[model samples]
Target: MNAILLILIMIAMGAIIGGATNSLAIKMLFRPYQAVYIKNWRVPFTPGLIPKRRKDMAEQMGRMVVDHLLTPEGMQEKFNERGFQKQVIQILQREAKGWMHSKRSVADLLKQYAGVTDARGKMTAYSEEWIDKKLQMFIYHNQEKSIDEMLPPEWKISAESYFDSFAARIADKGARYFESDAGRVQLETLLEKFLQGKGSVFNFLSSMFGNDKILDKLQPELVRFFRDPSSAMFFKGFIIKEWEKLLDQPVWKAGAQLNTKSVARYSVKALNRELTVLDRLDMPIAEWAPSYEEHIINKWIPELWDQVQPALSAKLLSVFDYLELEDVIRERVDTFSVGRLEAMVLAISGKEFKMITYLGALLGGFIGAFQGLFALFFS
Candidate 1:
């Protein structure tokens, strides 16, 4: 009985010591968050293991996250997942639906979202400036080139045909004019002027014939000359000579004749007037694009997603590199307070830690039982 009592006491003592030691050890893992020192002699294990190695742990965790958990391949896989793609498409469709049905005018949206004060005025100014810049660039680049060089190849190829048509029209109009009463009166007046310019002998001959008679003869001849096909050739030759002279002049001379600022302003105005959509800037989007839900939401969105998904998947690695996610995780983990970190760890494994302490007590009690039996056997 006494032996039995001694064994029980030994087991109890062993159990107590083991449990207490383990509990203390567990507490020490997080307690004494800061280093403890006595007059420059630092106490061993002054700070907890977690606290001491927090930075290194943080760095390891960051590497682990980047290397294993949040790898580019993993991210790309997630992006390619059908469920994720569907979710993204659904979200986009919802946004499109909202905007499509919105009663807000484009001007209002621009003012609200983009901080634009006057959408029309701003667009007009921007267009005018763009046009002016383009015109200036064109003038500067082609200033040294003659108009003939500046003209398109197609225009040069068809130049003769255009000249022929113009000359034929001019001859026909001239012949008609000369056959009219107006042409006869004009001819008589011209004859009078010519006879007056000539000597008295020509003047006497003109008087003998009379201005009316002279004009009657000359007017018919003028009409016939204009009616002749060669007359058209004559006008065409004259026009070709003038056109050649004009084409020989440099582009800068032609540009100098234009009012570029006025041209830009008028061009912008004409564009604004002609582009019927600009007039509807103040109208609600729903009113103008009633089929937006049908076209943009149903058809366009899916097509756009299909095109973008592959490209985005391919670029996930680049995106992750740009983000430097490992450093981000490391910084975040390092910045956590020791107490907070301890609490987090405890929250995850508190039950397991208690079981460890209990196991230590059981193992110590078993060893104590064996020692007590040995001592008893020896006695």
Candidate 2:
């Protein structure tokens, strides 16, 4: 009975020792968050394993996140997901709808970023200054590209057409005038004045040669020529031919002849007229802005997003570099305290560690039983 009791005591001691050892090992992983020092010497297993290697672990985690977990490829795949894109578009549409309906003035929306306010600390009406500045920059950049280069040749109205139209109108008016008796009399008087304006010698020659009679007779012929449709057509064709000759000259030479300052002044005046009409609105901006915004949302956004999808990989790489992704990951990991780290580990594998401790105790009990049997047999 005593021997049996001794064996039980040994088994219990072994089991307790094994369980305590396993528990201590588990505790060692997280205890003593800082290094323990004894004067000039350092204590064994002073700092916990996790605390000792915290920096290395953080760096490894950062690399893992950048390389294997949050890689460019993985991010691009997420961006390409149709469901994800649809969700994003839906969110944008909602926000845009809210913004469009909001009572906030255009200035109110922009004042946060631009800070263009009045003396009362209230947002002022939208200013054309920024628009003017941007437009000037655009014009400066495009100065080298002539207007003709921007417009296709087919879009230009032919010079012949304008000339033909002008000539036809003039000929029609002249025909109407010559068809009247007043026009015939005016022509006779003009010819008479011309003949009399010459010296008396010329008038004597005109009388001797019947030039005065010839001039009186020529009036009806002149009237017929002006009224005739064939003559009218000829004059129109002549004007168009002259216009074509002008058009055939180099465009640059024609442009050089024009006063660019006058052109710019007139263009700006016309644009300002239209813009002023828009500014003094009969209807609310909200009514018209939706149509424009809807156009952008429905047509432009899809096209823009399509373009962005193809370039996402390169853009993601650039963004990651700009964001300092590795350092960000490292910094976030380093911010975790030792207690937080222990909690995170325990959350992951607490049950497994508990099982390890129990297994240690079971193994120790079996070994002690065997030792008891050996002692009983050898004795």
Tens digit of per-residue lDDT, candidate 1, span 85-115:
9999999999988887789989999999999
Q: What TM-scores do the predictions have?
A: 0.62, 0.60
| Model 2 per-residue lDDT tens digits across residues 163-243 | 656766777677677667777677667767778879997788778867547656776677667666777678888886665
Q: What ranges in model 1 sit over 4 Å off?
A: 1-12, 102-115, 131-290
Q: For model 1, give the RMSD to the true fold.
A: 7.3
lDDT (Cα, 0-100) at 121 in candidate 2 = 21
Shift of residue 140 alpha carbon in model 2, Å: 9.5
lDDT per prediction? 0.88, 0.71
